[model samples]
Target: MPPEDEPKVEIKLCSENDLVLLNKAIPEPGYHERRFASQQDGKASYLLAWQNGVPVGHLLIKWEGSGPQVNKYLPDTPELNAIGVWPPKNRSKGIGGQLIEKAEGMAKEKGFKQVALAVEIDNSRAKELYEKLGYMDWGHGEYIDEWVEKGDDGEETQHKDPCYYLVKNLE
Candidate 1:
């Protein structure tokens, strides 16, 4: 549960123009900026949850499925990826759930019949959240999740992690 003074959270789709402002709200550097750029380029979409005008939560809507992060097993299924809530203390307060619901609404609006996502096999907390929200583990499969981080010198470093895929029907 959040503290009594925590501000009410507002969830909405992020536009390209909101990138700069949203980046400021995220304490971590580069992460939100990369997501914002992806959204701006139409490669992905995001639902940002703001509390007191600061982004405290976010969920990424990926129409392309998981790509290298997971196999293209469900090619037609849009994915809800990178769901997060800020300031560890702010978790379990319904903010993540609200962001997920908003992402589902967006997916339905886009004409998708269902949605998919991958969770690290060890992340029971996140898996539980998704399960509570109606996502189901179809089964376990291995995939090399990939990511790239840019250094201050403008060089990119790549990394990969293994994960399991999950799915949910929006119908």
Candidate 2:
């Protein structure tokens, strides 16, 4: 683990512009952080993965609401919505996991009972990382028929991707 006060990395409050950068970082972003931030106060926070003063990763949290998979499950659960480390150059350096831990810490600081998130069931890398860090599955269901799985090589696979609800008990 990096030092508690690593100058190269920071977990800070963000504005609307941060959300735009986060959307660009994640493949299919669903919500912009600023808009969500507009409706929330005292219960939300975002963390940026910075290195050498560049925003290389994003970790945005939100109160319980339905994200992409809400149709398959209710949206009443609070969660850390979008977390992504940008580009090949910025990934696998432990930033993604760090942001999640930071977000979970922040959520606890803000007094949320537990933190929840939705992940594409097929993304084992992300899921494994989450599980290894103590996040657990609460529920899951299949895609909306039009969805198709794509491999790292960009080849389509018949596996219908299901989205899962993941939770981390804060207390």
Candidate 3:
């Protein structure tokens, strides 16, 4: 159980099995698998957000120079690589925001001067959440080239930009 006021949200250090669970929570195809592979082969710090033994969110963090897909928006290093709350279970429960808060605190404790993350400009929910949490809009708009498309067989097709970049600096 977590301390009082923390809402008992259990955050777990990710393992391979948890990868499947995380993938189910996130809509992005192959993202969890890729992150898991990266972590397995010596890579980033990954976290899975769970509530009462049920995985509801996913948070994958990697340094800016280390290779976040949206590194172009980051200033220096250590960006929050990926964050997503399972749609049906998300419901403004503050799960994603709490994970971000935890991420910032962890980064600060590690002597990091700053942390960063890029949200899709079109994702008003994410953008609003970041802004409310004190994440300032820093860089201008930009888009990533590798696009992901849904195929007829429910497969993902890598193509071009799907959304605009909206970076926020963690202070």
Ranking by TM-score: 1, 3, 2
Best by lDDT: 1
- The best candidate by TM-score is 1
User: Is candidate 1 or 3 superior in TM-score?
Assistant: 1
Predicted candidate 3 versus true structure: per-residue lDDT over 88-137, tens digit per residue: 54647778877887877777777776676666656888778877877665
User: Comparing candidate 1 with candidate 3, which one achieves the higher lDDT?
Assistant: 1
lDDT of 3 at 53: 69
Tens-place lDDT per residue, model 2, 66-156, is 4555523543456675688777666666888878888877667767667777678678888888888788876554432234455557677
lDDT of 1: 0.79
Root-mean-square deviation of every model: 2.9, 6.5, 4.2
Judging by TM-score, tell me the better candidate of 1 and 2: 1
Q: Candidate 1 regions off by >4 Å?
A: 1-7, 68-72
Candidate 2, clashing residue pairs?
64-77, 64-78
Deviation of model 3 at 29, angstroms? 6.3
RMSD of 2: 6.5
